[model samples]
Target: MSIRANLDVVHERIARACLKSGRDPAEVTLVAVSKTFPLERLQAAADQGQMVFGENKAQELDEKATAWTSSDVEWHFIGHLQRNKAPVVARHADVFHALDSVRLARALDRRLEEENRTLRCLVQVNVSGEQSKFGLDPSALAPFLEEVAQFERLRIEGLMTLAAPTDDPEHVRPQFSLLRSLLSTPAPGGNTRLRALSMGMSGDFEVAIEEGATHVRVGSAIFGNRSYQ
Candidate 1:
């Protein structure tokens, strides 16, 4: 299917999921995962009014950020960000979706401070305890945020997680639920700024939305299968 048609289907699914959960569809932001896709495909989606795009690589994101000058487009860095690439990501990304470590945060913070800009970020949680996944343990979120709060250039917007891969989305619903619960937890000040839940992707975004995902990163479903080397 064409990108526009795919987007239509995805949006419809999101709306249906929201209806089932008794939530507003507007509350969910679709981050079209454009990582590894060609510029033409990305442009195709952009032409269809897709404003938010997610990239899993810092270099790819920077290249796209440089090419797409539209103020309407939001670049989200959703991959495992390394300290060395922090400068590129800090300069380009409107939001960082997989902030999983203090060391990486410090690196990004320093770069953002140099540019004199704040980067909105989501703390990634290893809800499924997968060794292959890169995220902070669920128990470490508060302390991680405490340390991250000291970095004036970083804004702790919310949480993100990749549910364990499964053919049945229901199998990973608990991971999504755990993330939602974490987002609702009040900070020490009795109020929480963590309103964003950057969970979900092409395969299981509908389930993620029902479990309270504020931002869903969708790839293949919209762009088709990625041409990986």
Candidate 2:
């Protein structure tokens, strides 16, 4: 299928899922995951009025940020961020989606302070209990939040997670539910604005949306298989 055709199907699925979940179709934002895809594909999506593009690598995003500097695209960093690379990420990303630990958050916070800027980030939760994933376990979220909430440069927008991939939807549902439950936990001082849930992708975004995903990361569903430069 063509890129546009894929996008059409994905949008249709999102709409249907929204209907089932009693959510407004317009309320669910589609973030095209452009990681490892060509710049032409990104331009094509832009032509189709896609404003948000997510990338998984700091170097890749830095290159895109330079090449597509003229385009009005909202770049989101949606990969596991090492503390050492936080400064580079701070330079270009509009939003950081995989902020899993307070240490990394503090690193970015320090960089933002030097750059005189603030960043919007999601606290990535490892709801699947996957040791391979880089995210805070649900139990550690409160202390992590408390630690990072002190930073003036970082704004905690919401939570994000990658459900462990499984063919059966039932296996993934708990991961999604755990994320949703964590979001409902009221923060101290009622200042935590947990509005965004960056979950799901091409394979399971519909389930993710039905469970309360405000932002879904879709790549292959829209762009098909990515071709490297």
State which candidate has the highest lDDT: 1
TM for every model, in the order presented, reads 0.96, 0.94
Error of 2 at 40 (Å): 0.8
TM-score of 1: 0.96
lDDT for each residue of candidate 2 in 1-229, tens digit (9 for 90 to 100):
8777777888899999999999998888899999998799888888878889999988899899889957588899999989988987888888889988778877998999898888888989899887898888888888877777788888888999999988876679778888998987666533257888999988888889989998999998898876775
Candidate number of the best TM-score: 1
How far does residue 172 in candidate 2 sit from its true spot (Å)?
0.7
List candidate 1 segments past 4 Å from native: 186-192
Model 2 misplaced stretches (Cα beyond 4 Å): 189-191, 227-229
Question: What digit string (tens of lDDT, one per residue) describes model 1 on residues 190-217?
Answer: 2226989999888898899999999999
State the displacement of the C-alpha of residue 183, model 2, in Å, after optimal TM-score superposition. Answer: 0.9
Local distance difference test values of all predictions, in order = 0.89, 0.86
